[model samples]
Target: MSRTIFCKKLQKDAEGIGFKPFPGELGERIYDNISQEAWQMWLEHQTMLINEKRLSLMDEDTQKYLADQMDKFLFGGDYDKADGYVPEGK
Candidate 1:
């Protein structure tokens, strides 16, 4: 499935597992407010993105951040993982 489609399914699955998407952007925004540990964890996941090709089932920006993180790690390698935020593709 395409990125967006996959992400929607992923979120739906997460909800099924009892994790709601943040109540709103405020509950999710972390750019400059995340703890250092969280940031490091994000970076570690980014490394996985660079090492693998599985698309995330999260929102668009989150998916993009993964791609960018992978790019940074891989030295500008191409990333085709789906942008899973928008629910357009299926």
Candidate 2:
């Protein structure tokens, strides 16, 4: 049976990730509180942030920035939107 969590991002109960995606306390927190659907949403948003900002994954500062953004997107009560992005069919 699949595990479930009360996803912080979507504010609903949903399927949980089977394991921690990151390597520290933040990952643990996510594992305990985030859902797979929310994580997937974050992945798509992260891709947009990377492409829009031209973020280099090899750069430490860029990695830190993305991590900070991830934290905000997940549990900080605020999520960053890609610049000039509009939801479809709005």
Candidate 3:
């Protein structure tokens, strides 16, 4: 059976990642608090941010920005949205 976590993002128990998806303390925190569903949502949001902002993974600044966004998206008050993006059928 899959593991479940008390998801910080969703504020409920949900399916969890089998391993840490990122590195360090923050990653450990995520593994302990975030659900697989919330992580997938973040992945979609991150993709939009990367595409709309033309961010380069090779740049340290871009990496830092994404990491900050990830933390905010998961645990902070202000979640980032891709500027000018409208969901399909919205």
Q: Pick the candidate with the highest TM-score.
A: 3
Q: Which residue pairs in model 3 clash with each other? A: none
**Candidate 2: regions farther than 4 A off:** 87-90
RMSD of 3: 1.1
Total backbone collisions for each predicted model = 3, 0, 0
* Tens-digit lDDT track of model 2 for 2-82: 897899888899999998988799999989999999899889889989988888999999998888899999896576777
Question: Cα RMSD (Å) per model?
Answer: 14.6, 1.7, 1.1
TM-score of each: 0.29, 0.89, 0.93
Candidate 1 or 3, higher TM-score?
Answer: 3
- Which residue pairs clash in candidate 2? none
lDDT of each: 0.39, 0.88, 0.90
Candidate 3, residues 1-90, lDDT tens digits: the string is 689889999999999978899999989998999999999999999998999888999999999999999999998668678779986689
lDDT of 1: 0.39
